[model samples]
Every structure is written in structure tokens, then in C-alpha cells.
Target chain A: MKTLVIVAHPQLADSGTQQFLKTSLQNFSTVTWHVLAPDVDVAAEQALLRRHDRIIFQFPLYWYSAPALLKHWEDEVLTRNFVYGAQHELAHKELGIVVTTGDAKREFVAGGKEDYTMSELLRPYQALAHKAQMSYLPPLPIFQFAYLTDAQKQALLVTYQQYITNSDFTSFHGQELWFEGQLKAKIDQTKGTSKQQLTQILTAVQDNREQLEELRWTLSLIKDNEDE
Target chain B: MKTLVIVAHPQLADSGTQQFLKTSLQNFSTVTWHVLAPDVDVAAEQALLRRHDRIIFQFPLYWYSAPALLKHWEDEVLTRNFVYGAQHELAHKELGIVVTTGDAKREFVAGGKEDYTMSELLRPYQALAHKAQMSYLPPLPIFQFAYLTDAQKQALLVTYQQYITNSDFTSFHGQELWFEGQLKAKIDQTKGTSKQQLTQILTAVQDNREQLEELRWTLSLIKDNEDE
Candidate 1:
């Protein structure tokens, strides 16, 4: 799919995470990068958006949110008639957000100074996606890149390259339930399973469940602590 | 107290509710009205903020949230070391929000298309206020202004004036539990209420709670019906 990445960072030259991601996507002819500064013309932005199939808002999270210019772009480019009231201009198009956060994943949880989960922090964007009638993708979050060693940064860059180029991204909606159903179906597909086969499948499912539970528990604990 | 009103409508001239409020506030010598359009200089904005005791963010809700420019202002003006991190510049300042919602009050509930109450939608601002160490005031919601009759609009303007000018504004924050323990001791002497009279004084507290619950339930019901 033709992807339009709207890169919004005040100082891209100084942004290691953003620069690395942009450089990685440089070889992809299908991907168009629109470097949006605060002074970008509104008409030009709207025109650029009209030509794209999938729109990705790429930004460094400033004070737990997108920088001012990106927010300004949303206000100007997403007009009432086009994005909301008239309907269908953005319908069926995919909307994605790629954010580079300053803090570790733990700092975004309930008790952290940020006082909200990444999901909670991005609810406004989800609401915007709903209004625009676009299919919202799960955000690609690069956490604590500022603290990463050079080797760690390279590893993250590799992961990011894989993340962006992957064609069959899992949809964000009801993800857990969908994955669970898939796992059950896979288990059922094995007809006349031996004890060994059953044990293997069960082990994989148990491992997946354990990982999911750990993530869920950590998030819940953070949320509970935040409430206090 | 000096009140700084940051009017954050992309097209303030065309906005019915915002225009009316702006016109009504023209005679108030104590109120410093800052019209924050897309073109506002970041440095000038910060300088203006430093002079005010009370800061009010005025906007029309777009896509169940504040207009993007308001978010832009938050990102740009509420900087690190000033709003947070360093000794707080906004610690003693009172922050308020005045929102003109296109959706009816009934349409902002649990099951509605909006799927959130105004309070829930406004959590980010509250979190920002908490971080900034500012006294967060209850939002002044001008609901269904498009449907209001001329007489009703006039009455609303009067209420708006009272809300902005009232000397006993501390009472509004006093009713909020988040502020109760923190601010009650300091203001209790002024309230002439003994410790024994706290229960009797909490009648207003109970009333505010009931109203908030009613609003939440009504919004949810409206949203549920809208989808059908």
C-alpha cells in the first residue's frame, strides 16, 4: 500500500529515533515522507493527504503528547466538511501513529508521573479516527530511545523496519479475543492429535497466555497505583 | 483576580457561542482576553501566561475533544521547567476550561458514539493541571448552543459573566473532593464553618455529585439511542 508518513518533529536533525526511522524507509519508493514544520501551508497539507492511501503521523512525544505543529496540522487539514460532516473522504483509509517516547514503558503506567497508559494517552487520536471514519491501527511505540546504547538503538531500528514494512499487521480492535479464537482454531485443526502434539500446542498457548497476563497485570497494577 | 482567557477557535469570527462570550467579556476591564489563533508566537504566549493569576482555555469541542490548536497551545506553551520539572510557575495559578460542545450533553455518555463523558474526555487537561500544580477548576460547558433560543443564549451570557467575575469562585473548587483536603483548611476561616459544620456544608458536595452522575447517565443513554 502507498503510505504517506507525516513526520512532525521540531528538531529532526537532533532527533536520533526519527532520523533513523526516516533513513530506514528511504529505499522504499512506495513510501512518501512529508516533513511537516509548524509553518506548512494548510492547503498544501490537505492536497498531500488526498493523494495518500494510508496516513501515518510520526512524532516525538512531547510532554506525553504530540508536538504543537502536529496538533496544528490536524486542526487545519482535517476540516469539518472533508473529515467529519461530509463523510467518506478518509473512509476505508488506514490511519496510524508512530510515536517515540522519552520515558520507559513503565513510566507511562498508572502510578508513573505521566499518570496514564499509552492507550489512554492516545484516546484523543482514536476519537479523531472514529470521527474521520478511518480504520485506526495500533500505534508503533519506540520507548526510551534517549537512554538506549548504540547497539540497542540498532536493534530497535531493525524492529522498526520490520514493523513498517510488514504487510499483514494484526488489527488493533478486539486483538486479544481474535488471537485467542485463532489459537483455539489452530488446536482444533489438528485432527486425531497424539499426547505429544496436544502437549506441544498446550505449551505454546500457555506460554502466550503467560506473556499476555504479565503485560495485563503490570498495566493493571500501574493503573491501580495511579488511582490511589 | 486577573483572568487570562485564551480563546482557541480556528475561526473565532464565525463561532456563535465563542463570539457571544467574547463580546460579553469586552466590558470586563479585569479580564485579559488573548485571542490564540493559529499564528500566535510561542514566546509572546508564554510571556502573557506569566502575568495572569487565572488562565481560562476557551474552545469549541471538535471530534469530542478540544480544537487541535488548544492542544497545540498546551504542547508549546506549557513547557518543561516552567509548567513542570522546575519550581512551578503555575503552582498558585488557577486553570479553567470553557467549552462549546456541538453535541448535546446527552450525547456524551458511556454508550453514546462519543463513548465518554466531558470529564473523561477532558482527563488529559486535568492530568496536565495536576502536573503543573495548578488549581483545576470545573469546566464551563455551553451545551446545545446551536439549538438554544435567543432568550436562552442571553441568559447563558449572563451566567457566563457571573461565572467569570464572581469573587466567591473558591467555593466552586471547594466543592470538588480533589481540592477539599488541600484547600479547605486555608479557606475554612473565610467560610465561617466549624469542623462540626462540615457535614451540613457537604449538601452542595452531594448535589454536585448527583448532577455529575445524571450528566454521565444522560450522555450514555443518548449515545446508545443515536447508534440505533
Candidate 2:
């Protein structure tokens, strides 16, 4: 599915999180990065939205909501006729959010510093999705991007890519396939001794994926037998 | 209490509700209508906020949230330190909202056309109030202003004014006192037969107030006797 990442930040040039996300999605052929601005051509933006299957509203959370630029974009591009009118232009499409927060992720919970879940805080978008008849995905919240270790950053990059590309990202099996594709792509670009090591890793990943699939099939078969 | 109404509309001049509200509060010297712009002076805004006992965010609902201009003002004006830092600047101050929607009021409920309550859609503001240690008053939603009957319009005017001025607006006792005060003011400004009519109405209102107070006192006395 084609994904459109509409990023809105007042100081887009200075945000490290936006930079990291931009760099992470460089290899994604089916993804489009759309930066929101003060001036919006509503018709063009609406056309762009129609072209994409999944739309991602990516932003740094300010006051527990997106930056005003995104809101501005929404106000301009999401006219009533286009959103909930009789034609239902955006119906059955998917809506996702990638929110980056300066605060720790752990603090966004009951009795924590924020005293609210991320889900509760991001209800406006869900309400919009509901109104537009779009499928709302669980938000991908990246908290304390500056504090994340290298390993965590790597994991974030993978997850972010999958959020854009993989339809079954919530499952481990889908993630395994995503990782395998990345490994295969890496192997294609590599040569000599390092390529051999990468191929072996790819083979092991494939083995794991096949075993999981087989187990799932066997479990379904057992359930069927029980029903009989 | 001094009320600061920070209004944010992309085209404030065109909004009928803003005009109505502005006309309604003509004689209210304690209420200040501060229109938000793209450029914000954070220190000045915070100082203004500090001066007011109550701060109101007045805007038309854009996609179930405030217009982008309001969010822009919020992002610029409400700095982290000024709101929730060591000083606790806005603590105990009242934060109220004046949200105008073109849709029917009854449509903003569970299973209604809007499918979500106004309270649910406006949680972001409440969350901000919580973070600042401010008291969040119930939002005043003005629905379908164009379609309101003349009587409804008058009621809306009174409610909008009371929301800004009256401390106990949710209680019938509070409304009775408010109407009494309003009637007295009208009586003072009038002459001849009209003044006499207003005075009679005021007297009748006062009598009702006394009766309610007497009933409340008797109920409390009965409770005390029960305790004895």
C-alpha cells in the first residue's frame, strides 16, 4: 500500500526526530513525504490524499496535539465535502499517526507526569478518522528520541519503515518478513565475505518464518479437527 | 472577575458568532476581547494571562477542534516554564472554552450524527488545563447560530455573557441572581411605565429567590433535626 507521510513542524529544519524519520524512509519507494506549510493549495493536497492508501500524520506533540501547521493543513485540505460528504472520497483508507515527544514515554500514563494515555490524548485524530470513514491505526509514539540508544534507534527505524509499508505490522510474522526483505536487499548490494555472512543470517530468518507459518497452520488444523 | 477572551479565527471579521458575542458584551468593561494573530509575544501573552482571573479560548470548531490559529497561539504563548514550571503560574486560574459549530447541538452525542460528545472532542484543552494546574470550566458550545430562533439567540447571548461573568452559572440559584441583577440594571436605565414593569418583574424574581432560600433552609433544618 502507498503511504503518504504528512509532516508538520514549525521548525522542520531543526527537528532531529523529523530528520531521523526522513533519513529512515529514504529507501521506501511507495512512500511520499509531504511537508505542511502556511500556504496550502486545497485542491492539490486533496488530490495527493486521494492518491495514497494510508496517510500518516507525523509531528512532534505540542500541548498533547500536533503542531498548528498540521491543524492548518487539516482545516484547509479536509473540506466537509471531501471528508464526509455524499461521495465519501477518503472512505476505507487508513489513517495513522507518528508522534514524537520530548518527554519520556513512560510518563504518558495513569498517575504519571502526563496523567493520560497516548490513545486518550490522540482522540481528535481518531474522531476525524471516524468521521471520514477511514480505518484508524494505533499511533506510533516515539518518546525521548534524543535519549534512545543506538539499538533502540535501529529498532525504531525498522518499525517506522514497517508502519509505512507492512499491512500486518502488528504481528511478529509480518515483521519477520519485513526484516527478511531488508536482508535480501542488503545481500543484493553486498559482495564477497560479508555477503556470505548476510546470506546465512537471511537463511536463518527464512527458516524461523517458515517454522512459524507451519505451526500456525497445524494449530488451525487442530482446531478444525476439534470442531469436527 | 476579569475575563480575557482570546479569540482565534482565520477570518474573524466574517464570523457571525464572533460579531454577536462582541455586540453582546458591549457594556462589559471587565471582559477583554484579545484576537489571536500568527505572530505572538509570549511574555506579553503570559502577563495578560496572569492578569485575568478567567481566560477563554473562543473559536469556531474546525474538524472537532479549535481553528489552527488558536493552536498556533497556544503553541507560541503557553511556554513550558510559564505554564507548568517551578512557578506554577496559571494554577487555580479558570480556563474556559467558547466553541461555535455550524452543526445542530443535538447531533453531538453518542449515536448522533457527530458520533462523539463535545466533551470528548475538547479533551485536549482540558489536558492542557490539567498540566497548568488550572481549573477547567465546562465548555460553552454554541451550535447552529444561524438557525437559532430569536428566543434561543437571546438565551445564547445571556449564556455567553454569564459564562464569562458569573461564577456560579451552573446553578439555578446563580441564574436567578444573574437575572435579578440584569433586571435591576434595566430598571435603572428605563423610565416611566417600562421601569415600573421591570421593577415588578425584579420584585417577583426576588420573591422566588427568597422562597427557594427559605425552602433550602427548612430542608437543612430538618436534616439537622434528623441528626439530633
Candidate 3:
């Protein structure tokens, strides 16, 4: 599937984790990286979105949420007739988020300083996904990136690379596995795990991974193709 | 104090309750109603915000949260160094929300379709307020605006007028009273209530109705002055 990664960091050039992830996607040929600002031309954005099957919003968690420009993009780009109401254009697209958090994951819970789970904090986006009729993937969270040891950061970078490129739902090595487990449990319970069903599930997962990798590769080629 | 109302309605002209509230504010002299949108210029927005002591975000609740644009404004206007970090511009300013909900207040709870309280859904804003060192008031939620009788809406208009003008904090009536009661209980227990304090509380409650009316008048005048 074609993927559009909308990088929404206010100062992406200064970002280590986001910069690293953006650089790593250079090897992939299917993903289309769109570094968006609030002032992006609407027609231009629509064209970029039309080429992608999945739209991934990547940002650093600011005040427990996304930066303002991304919010502006959603407001302006995801217009009424296009994103909601009866004839929404974004109905077929898949929506996901890749966020780097300054705080640890444990700090985003009931008794924690943040006092809300990441899921609960990000529920607004989930609600938006539901309204837009898009399949919402669980967020890819990189917690405490600033404090990570060099080795830990390297490990995180590798995991993040694997996550963005891997389409196989079952083999996702990053934090996305938490969401995958939730999805697996639901599917397993609903379908009743017969041997044939299990095989199909595994195959679908692998296929999804390959599609994701292709998307990454495609995105890297967009700039080169435009130059030519 | 000059109060700024940042109104965020996808279609403000089409909304009945919101339109009425917007109309009522015309009677006040100290209120600045800022109808926010993507088209609004950034420098102009910053200037408007700098002029106001109290910033109130008014919006119809969408899927148990603010619309995308409102979130965008929060992200954009409330910047790191300005709103937080070393230099705090909005420090000491009062931040409030005036939200209109389609569902009843009871429906935003543990067993409801939302499975979360309005307070929980709005935690991100509250967190923003805390981080920015602004006094975060409990949101003024107009539950089931469509279901309200004309008389109820009229009364609400009056109460909302008081809320926006920062007149008597306790005069406006709604389920917010219950929320305030809960807050009061916490406050009462912490500081033993002296007779003078009790008198002050009683006077504040008694003055609410008139204070709200006076506030509306004050805000309307402010709007008129700005228009000229």
C-alpha cells in the first residue's frame, strides 16, 4: 500500500529521532514523505494525499498532543465534504500516528504525573478516524528519546526503521506490537483460531509488512522523480 | 480584565446555540470575540491574544473533543518559549472553555458510549494550562443544546454572558454547579471556612445572576469599540 508520512515537527531539522527516521526511509521506494507546514497549498496537499493509501502523522508530543500546524493541516485539508458528512474522500484511506514522547510511557497513566493513558490522550484522533471512516492504527510511540542512552537510541532507531518498513502485522518488533496484540486478541476470539485461519492470518500479516516496505521505498523516490 | 473568546465552530453561522451565544456577547464592552479559523493571520492572532487577560475557547464538542482547528490554534499560538519553557507570556492569564455538547452530561461517564468524562476528554487542555501556569477553569458545557427549550436556551445565554465577562463566577447555573460544588468541597476541607469566608462565598453565589448580565453588557461594548 502507498503511504504518506506527514512529518509535523515545528523544528524537524533539530530533531534527532525524527531526523534519523526520515533519513532511514531514504532507502525505501514506496513511502512518500510530505513535510507539511500550516501554510501548505490545499491543492498541492490533495494531490500528495491522492497518491497514498495510508497517511501517517509523525510528531513530537507537545503538551500531551501534536504541534499546532498539524492540527491546522487536519482542519484545513480534511474539509467537510472531503473528510466527513456523506461523500467523504478519505473514507478508503488508513490513518496512523508516529509520536516521540519526552516522558516515559509509565508516566502517562492513572496515578502518573500525566494522569491519562496514551490511548486515552490520543482518543481524539481515534474519534476522528472513526468519523472519517478510516482504519486507525495504534500509535507508534518512542518514549523518552531525549534521555535514552546511545545504545538505547540506536536500538530505538533500528526498531523504528523495522516498524515503518515492515508490513507484516505479526512481526512488528517495536511498541506497535502492543496494538498488534490487541488486534490479534480481537481477531482470534471473533474468528476462532482454526489451523487454516491461523495460516491466513500469518500470510496477511506478512503481506501487510511487504506493502509497508514498498510504501517507504516509493516515498523516497517522489523527490527524485520530481527533480527529473 | 479584557476577555477574549476564541470561537471555533466549523460553521458558526449555521449553529443555533453558538450563534445565539455569539450574538449575546455583542452586549458586552470588555469582551473580544475572536472567531478562529485557518484563514486568520498568525501575527494578527498573536496581537489579539496579547491584548486579552482571559482567553476563552468556545467550540461545539466534536466526538467528545474540540474541533481540529481549535487544537491547531492551541498548538500554533501557544508556543514553547512563549507559552512555556523560560519565557511565559500567558502566565497569570485565566484560560477557560465554553463547550456545547450534543449529548447529556450523564452520557459522558464510565458506562456511557464515550466511556470517559468530559473532564477526562479535556485533560490535554488542562495539562496545557498547568504547564503554561495559567489558571484553568472547569469548562462551561451546554449539554444537549438541541434538546433545550427556548426558555432554557435564553437562560443559558444569560449564564454564558456572565461566564464570558468574568463577572460573578458562581451566578451562572448548570451542571457546572455540581462540578464547582465538588471543587468547593475540596477547597473547604483544605482551609477551614471562617465566617468572613462563608460570607464571601454566599455573596459571590448571590451576585452571580447580576454579575453575568453586567459582564455581557461590558463585552458587547468592547466588540462595538473594536468594530469602529
Worst 10 residues of 2 chain B by lDDT: B79-88
lDDT of 1 by residue, A40-97 (tens): 6867777777887788888988755677778777767788877867656788777888
List the candidate 2 regions with Cα displacement exceeding 4 Å: A224-228, B223-228
lDDT of 2 by residue, B94-192 (tens): 999999989888888888877788988888898898899999999999888999899999989999999998878889999888888778888888999
Question: Cα RMSDs of all predictions?
Answer: 14.7, 2.2, 16.9
For residues A75-189, write the lDDT of model 2, one tens digit per residue: 9889888998756889999999999998887888878888788988888898899889999999999999999999999999988999988888999987888788888998999
Q: Chain B TM-score per candidate, please.
A: 0.71, 0.92, 0.72
Position A115, candidate 2: lDDT: 77
Give candidate 3's root-mean-square deviation (CA, Å). Answer: 16.9
Q: Which CAPRI category fits model 3?
A: acceptable
Model 2 reproduced share of reference interface contacts:
0.73
**lDDT of each model, Cα atoms only?**
0.74, 0.91, 0.75
Q: Deviation in angstroms for B68 in model 1?
A: 5.0
Single-chain TM-score of chain A, each candidate: 0.70, 0.93, 0.71
Sort all candidates by DockQ, best to worst: 2, 3, 1
Question: Which parts of model 3 are misplaced by more than 4 Å?
Answer: A39-51, A88-93, A103-107, A110-113, A170-228, B8-19, B26-54, B60-73, B81-84, B87-93, B100-118, B142-149, B166-228
Candidate 3 lDDT tens digits, B87-203 = 888888888989887777886777665556777778788777777778888788889888989899888876787677643466345534533453465455555556457657655
Error of 3 at B114 (Å): 7.0
